[model samples]
Target: MKLRLTAAALLFPLLCGAAAPQGAPGEKMRTEKVLRMFLSTSETGLDPAVASDNATLSLLENLFDPLLRYDYLARPAKLRPNTAAAMPEVSADGLSYTFRIRPGILFTPDPAFKGARREVTAQDYVYSIKRLYDPTLKSPWAYMFEGKIAGDETLRKRYGPDVPVAGLQALERYTLRIRLNAPDNNFLFYLATAATGVVAREVIEAYPGQAGNHPVGTGPFMLGDWKRSDRIVLLANPDSTAVFHATPGHNAEDRALAAALEGKRLPRVDRVEVKIAEEFQGRMLGFLNAEYDYLEQIPESMTDMVVRDGRLKPELAARGIVLSRFPVLQTYYMWMNMNDPVVGGYGKDKVALRRAISMAYNNAEDIALLKKGFAIKAESPLPPNVLGYDPSYRSPVPYDPALANALLDRHGYSRRDPDGFRRAPDGKALTLTMHSEATVGGRLRDELWRKCLNAIGLRVVFKSDKKTEIIKASRLGTVQMFESNWIADFPDGDNFYQLLYGPNAGRANYARFDLPAYNLRYEQARRLSDGPERQKLYFEMNQLIHAYNPWVPLTHVLSGDLRHPWLKNYKRHPVEFTAWRYLDVDVAERARSARGRGGNR
Candidate 1:
């Protein structure tokens, strides 16, 4: 069923909630309804250090709160205090960061924990960061903060076969100092992720094996119960001061950031419940049927239908749900494995081959066929929306098969065998394995990719696997060329720059391309305080990416979520924190007052 509906028809029904069988208004009126969420995978674990997948982190966000949170509408990537008393002090070089701990911040005890019920302290932060790097923990992300924190090597050496960890330290009771080997401006943003949220050290010690399952945080919601495949419940924190509301007189962005840091009430919602739904299509259908109060990962198909039909504005109004949209700094690219001989046939001439391969396909057509007008085609690794994207600069290659063929010929790939396959100068047929995740649009991509390669006399053997399988293959260096996308953990250029760094560099570098000059500038860009200097470094680094071409940049993925109209106070920030927080959710005030909280469970 083509979900192509006219906008006017969709909005017309929103004028009356009764017209739509199931709407946001009807769902919100129910007291104890569970919010059904669709996730592609069964959550691996809740440990922030090892939590790599987005799906699992999304659920964990409700159970944790970071020291500083992002104010999306604020300027220059606003950093508002959560557990901190004020903004952190960043050294002139951006290496040292000191924060004054907020007084009276308590860490609630988990039901599974045998620890004493008490408030969290700076010691917990010290222990938490150090624990992840402990050799005994075997945390994959222990290296993420490698050069940033002190004692990393000592900890690793001490715990080599026992329990090594080196990065974290506790200076004083309320004041903490963190020293980094190098400067990273976005380090504050990294601390904002739910996976990095602070936890009580006692909680971890009490139930060492069950820490992930039974979590605790200072967020407005407490982790009540989390059952794999059944349901996840977030009970309201009785002592939580989060009151989601805009300041009455504060209109300017700066004023709001100031107010947020002052510990003003933010969210209005009391509780949040998430029911796991694995099937993506089922989640979309159920959302349209209004079975959920709010659906975080909106079905892409339904978003397209609403956009084409123009029913979003009216449907949301009639149902009392709010619609919000923003651009996210996320890019989808194809990673070419240089380690494999057959796929890496171009070897030393990899840059020329990468440039040629980049020009073979029309990114615009790919978006039309795969993304359906939801995404923007990207020519550079850094999109124009990013801080230092150079608009005047352009890549050497263009979208032309003739040009692609010419580049190949220039690079000693001139021969085309009888079967019309490109061969190396040695008369060996060059073949590559193109790997892709089996998503909703995978089949379409398979057909489109085949056509693009055929035009350039290149034969591609496509392997489509589940998302997890594809990621594992890329990390293991088993795939030649594969599809991947990265959403910035924080709104900074380094997040993208570090991904293409040397082998086993950061979170997203699976292909492991190492360029010393590139890494040097990447480090400098993070440290340089001058705006112009940072811009220059970032621009130079990005241009080098085009010259090197380890990964072919494609397009920025457009993300959206569908919610019933009655689901109010729900909003999403652009970069950084994309998941919905329970604080913004406002139960129907009138309905709640009338029912007197005596309705359903």
Candidate 2:
């Protein structure tokens, strides 16, 4: 079946080159030196202080630079200095950190600069960190530094906007000193995240309350044009002097990738144009028609057509298309709102109900039938690549329909109504309402949910809506149960545990799970260094989550990206938000390939 384009896709003409005058064939085929891609949904905004979605975070990563970044090809990801001169100097107590800014870093030219060279200084970072604490902004990232920074809590309580934070200080023009309330080994990793990407104070002040739309920073790309939901354009910063430096790789594949990317000035493309294509079919058609250089996330429905026997299909391969796969630090799960009256309780019956539901849903079948074997059945919340993940840890909630039915029967749900659905203890019809998106894959998952729930003598009702609508409903606590995933902001177990932490309720904790013992263990684990002790704590937390069943851990997806062969040095970073700087596109080669493949649609 041919894909249908949405009205939004139809509105923007797919133009990769400038049109030459009437009879000039050679000039008509001129390449634009641009990288074209698609965003599944419109970006919420680009302000690092408030942007939380993947689309916004990805854009912000290129628009701003953090002090440190994750090594592109490392397996167990390592932190490296980006804007910092070197790794921070740590005090013996581990509570104090001192870093010096790399010289010659300048923000992209903007009105905020006021005709002066806006070089990045240590104070810029100090001010950027302070913005997270601004009460009016209410940055979602505030959780990262909440109690860790020594005096931040007090400053947050008393300050409104642009107040000086006591825990952070600019000791010199290039030097920054940060004092934390306690020792945290994972603190450096936190700084490496896109959430901490430094923004210039002048820019924030110039566009007060609108920095999300008007971003200015010292990164490889600057915002060229933005049309809200239609499109976004990023132009390579002419003033950027960032170069790709090689790192010693742990394996042969890493070494080869590093060698190919070494010493190249970023970003290789002159411009990046991102078009909004909300439908999977539209995105797939765009990629196949040579309108896009890369397909970032391949739709599950088209996975078989694109990839055959773990490789690109013959026709696509002959057209110089290549597939790259990487195991991401992400997990998709179904979360039950523990705050809901039907699902929330500490009693045996409540726990049994949740566990039975978890058991009834077959994650293995979902991976095989829906994901097409592109995912690993998740056993724990901490995915494979993270520090605290345990390979031997097995989920207590296995797929067992008989066990599920028996559990429900024992819990006083044995009575059946006229529809053959179970009745509650009070003789009311037992029905569950789940929120899902109105996408193809969503419909398939909802069907499976209905099948599984019906097998356990419960009727399931699905409320289908758009992706943003589902997210808004879930965040407002209006969703009783929902399917969601968390992509790690930093490669740490604490990042995952925060989703279940009571303090993060209504924010990251979509499940609204509030178990004091689990919360206590989560807090204890955060304070401990990464070692056997911390892994033990992680295991304990996993066991608690398994018993409580707030979220039935589903699958850890293996992300696949298909790109034109001319897109060189494209390696995936498991933790890093942006890696466009390391990528180079061969515009001539792409044009030649497109011509050989019978030209663009």
Against the true structure, whose TM-score is highest? 2
Worst 10 residues of 1 by lDDT: 1-10
lDDT per residue for candidate 1 within 132-163, as digits (tens), equals 66655555455457666765677655643234
Q: Identify the runs in model 2 with alpha carbons over 4 angstroms from their true place.
A: 1-32, 161-164, 248-257
RMSD each, Å: 9.1, 5.3
Residue 444 of model 1: what lDDT?
62
- Full-model lDDT for every candidate: 0.62, 0.81
lDDT of 2 by residue, 21-121 (tens): 55776665445567887777668767888877777888888888889987777657788888998899999999999999988998876667666878888
How much is the lDDT of residue 2 in candidate 1?
11
Pairs of colliding residues, candidate 2: none
Error of 2 at 115 (Å): 3.9
Query: Where does the lowest 10-residue lDDT sum fall in candidate 2?
Result: 1-10
